[model samples]
Target: MFLLSSLLCALAGHVSAFLVETSSLTDLYPPLWKECPGQFSDYRVENGVYTINPWLYPERMGMYKILVTFTAEYFERFAPNNEANILWGLPLQHGWQYETGRLADPTDETKCGRENGNHTCISVDSWWACMNYYLSVLPFFGAIEAGVLGISSDQVQLLPPPKDQMYFCYSVTTCRSTFPETMTKWSTFFQQAMEPSKSWDDLLKYLWDAHVASIEEGRTSFDDRSLYFPKPETDFGKSWATAMNYIAAIRFETTLQNVTKFQKALPPRLLKPDDPPYFIEDFTDSQNRFLFLLHGLNKMHNDSGHKFLSLFRNLMKSELLRKMANTVLEQIILDDNISPQELDIIFSGYI
Candidate 1:
């Protein structure tokens, strides 16, 4: 009996450790706001534009450091010294440092200097910035190249830089200008791909093809002069999609409860717009109505307990829809995996 009890205790300990590890992995990618509080604390939505506080970049950098460290630890544990991992990981590490430098002291010329007639740096921040400016962009460029080359996710590989080659800073100004355009082009492409009545699997395939085509046509590249879009390949796409679905599912369930609580807090007449005044006075202008609804919903979210739903019953119109969509998208990148079917499953009967 004592031996059996000891065995049971060991099993319990193993289970507990497993749960702890799993929880840590999930914490690596927390909700958007949770990941970077400084960046999101004062975030305001005005006319669909998101203007973040640049001064908060340091805090964002801090969050990135933790994330990068976790990523490095993951790689070290699973695939130490892997070239592909190194190729991507190094840049992220350097990029964080580079951004940190810019945040720390942007105007110090002595922060960056020349070595072997090439730009080097005395400060770690400047050095990292210079290297990251060149290397950080490569992973993005490499993804596009893989698509163009018809390389599968498993086949994706990057060539190491030549020895003695100077890793100097590229034109950050040019990259900033072109990157957004590339992103816009990809967004349009995805929207167009979804216009056809395709199954979820077909949509994923179409997105993959479109990504390749974009790269082949010189629409996306690492060069600051070229357009660039960040698209995950099959494996990463699947994993990302699964993660998004899990996040959405969890958030959807929690949000439904919150919505119920919000409803209870609202005034009765505002529930379904039975009275014309509810629609005319409160929701005549769509954007204005959304803003107003968001304000009230945010208040309810902050409040301690559930109140009467009738107080803000007008939220049933479209506020909940907007809130759910915004919340989900804010937490995850919009990828091909977010299909109509998936959305239907997530939002069905919620209204």
Candidate 2:
């Protein structure tokens, strides 16, 4: 009996060790995230990186992060976000920390050598500094899209949404990069679809019709992925329940994958010679819908700035908006304009 008890103890210890040492986000991934509620108890080590998937507690469904922490040697070389609150500040308590395994510049391939080891590859730099450069520098172009090209903030009669919404250009820019060719197609599509309209409904119908036509032509285009619509409910086609389900699906499928890190800026695109990949994950559909909704709200506020916020809040709960989206998809049929070669390019871009 004593031998059996001793073996059981040993087995329990081994199981505990495996749980802590695993690289993936063990049992921390919750289907729905709430506020960083309970104490953060789970921690696992994967591929030399420590990851906390659910982190503290999730308050929202779409806000989880996986954090990675590096070893002492690598931490000394490539210092990542180590402070507890820093990673938790992100949405959904979803984040990761990498103690090591980050290359300095995309051009520099050598690993930052171990502690006290003099290495030629180790460049004197901070991860924060590198991140700052990207977020601050390149993202100006996206701001130009919303601020200069789309509409100026000065003209905006309504106070902007929290920085969480208005300052998401970095994420949009990254989304654009994911499908450069697709974006090119989108640019052309939006250009044609953006013919001056009297109301938001007019703008939505124009784009929705175009999308349906594109799909019929064998193009895998989205219905409302580009947030360019103004009035979402000129025509109704789908039930509100269906629309909510769609939104939930969009949130679920779209996730953030940390390709690289930067301080407060966009990092240099690690995948290519000239580009710094934008950090942060986003739902392509949600980003578009949010943008379009904002643009429409901006216009409404301009026209009737008196009740813009109230209208927006109401619109959030409007069933007509969902019907408009669904009606557009169901009403129109598309013919493909993109050549077979263009399709090939689009396929390559996703990879």
Top-TM-score candidate index: 1
Q: How do the predictions measure up, each by TM-score?
A: 0.24, 0.19
lDDT of 2 by residue, 1-351 (tens): 999999999999988876665423333332233333222132343443323221112211121222212111112222222222112222211122111212122223324322333221222232311222222212222222333234322221111212222222223355345434433333443343223332333333322332223222221221232112112211111111122233321111111112111111111111222221111133222222322333333444445543644554455344566556444322221112433234335434332
Cα lDDT computed for each candidate against the true fold: 0.32, 0.28
Candidate 1 per-residue lDDT, tens place, 247-294, comes to: 222222221123232222122211221433113343323322322333
Model 1 earns a TM-score of 0.24
**Deviation (Å) of 160 in candidate 1:** 33
What shift in Å separates residue 60 of candidate 1 from its native position after superposition? 4.4
Off by over 4 Å in 2: 1-39, 43-293, 312-351
Error of model 2, residue 331, in angstroms: 12
